[model samples]
Target: MSGLDETLLDDTEATVRVRFVVNGRKVACEVAPRETLVDCLRNELELTGTHAGCEMGACGACLVQLDGRAVHSCLMYAVQADGARIDTIEGLTESGVIADLQAEFHRRNALQCGFCTPGMLVNAHELLSQVAEPNREEIRDALSGNYCRCTGYEAIVDAIDAVAKARCEGGGAT
Candidate 1:
């Protein structure tokens, strides 16, 4: 092949460098321009907690907190995360917020298959962060994007409501 053709080929196959802060750690890596955030997290950063289901963003299984907001990893390009703060499921529990929620989930038997647990936890965390005392309707609205094939959502709502009630009574609500 000619030099020009080789250059074109390289350009087509070139991996772009993406820089971002994941779970409070700086990360810089080369990834295909077309790669999604889920791929980068799982394959490059090795943060497998971000699941890939219904890659079209319909299923909230790939939920992650980007710049303090919950987003579907499969819907975002890895390059778009440059200079962003990313938090996968691994980061959710480190601050003890998710731990409390997890305890509540266990107490409520909110999880069954566990595939949707991470996304549910992250979404719940986001909801609680924004509204410390969200009602059942609000909690359901917050989790509208997430799909739970098991557990039927009653227990999940109960868990969240209990946590909210506890926080309100404990003066943890702001």
Candidate 2:
């Protein structure tokens, strides 16, 4: 109906019913048995913020937080996420927990094409949450799984470090 393509929703063969909480909302959908979490989010729920880069999980574009831990959605099947709480870029952005990080990223020009921003942010959120003040090597190690073709990662490292420092100093990019 309208501008939405119906065929995308009609292909339900060899599908399994999956129920999970996404972005604080409970979502239940029928997905193909081999459907990946990234595919389900992008195709079924339309949460395209989780990019599908290097679907084999080498690239971190399809990163999402599963039960507060960052995981590559491309590597996990949608069915595997059943009964789990999932959070994507949309959820983090809406919760305002990453506002400061986003601002720092923008100010530091950490993002170029923006494909890896979501995953980077998700991973950064995890890192910052765990380590109040991570060193340069720690930050780099945390983001090592995420591959950024553009920007050479210097700016991204700077942005995460800046946010961590500001937060520790009682003020940040928020």
Question: Candidate 2, overall lDDT?
Answer: 0.94
lDDT score for residue 112 of model 2: 96
Question: Number of clashes in every candidate structure?
Answer: 0, 0
Off by over 4 Å in 1: 1-10, 171-174
| Colliding residue pairs in candidate 2 | none
**Per-prediction TM-score:** 0.90, 0.91
- lDDT (10s digit) by residue, model 1, range 1-174: 445555646576688788999998898999987899999999999998888989998879999999999999999899998999999999877767677788889888999988888899889989888897999999999989889999999999999898888887984322
Candidate 2: RMSD to truth: 7.4
Ten-residue stretch with the least lDDT total in model 1: 1-10
Give one digit per residue, the lDDT tens place, for model 2 in 25-103: 9999998868999999999999989999999988899999999999999998999999999999999999999999999
In candidate 1, position 83 carries an lDDT of 95
* Cα lDDT computed for each candidate against the true fold: 0.88, 0.94
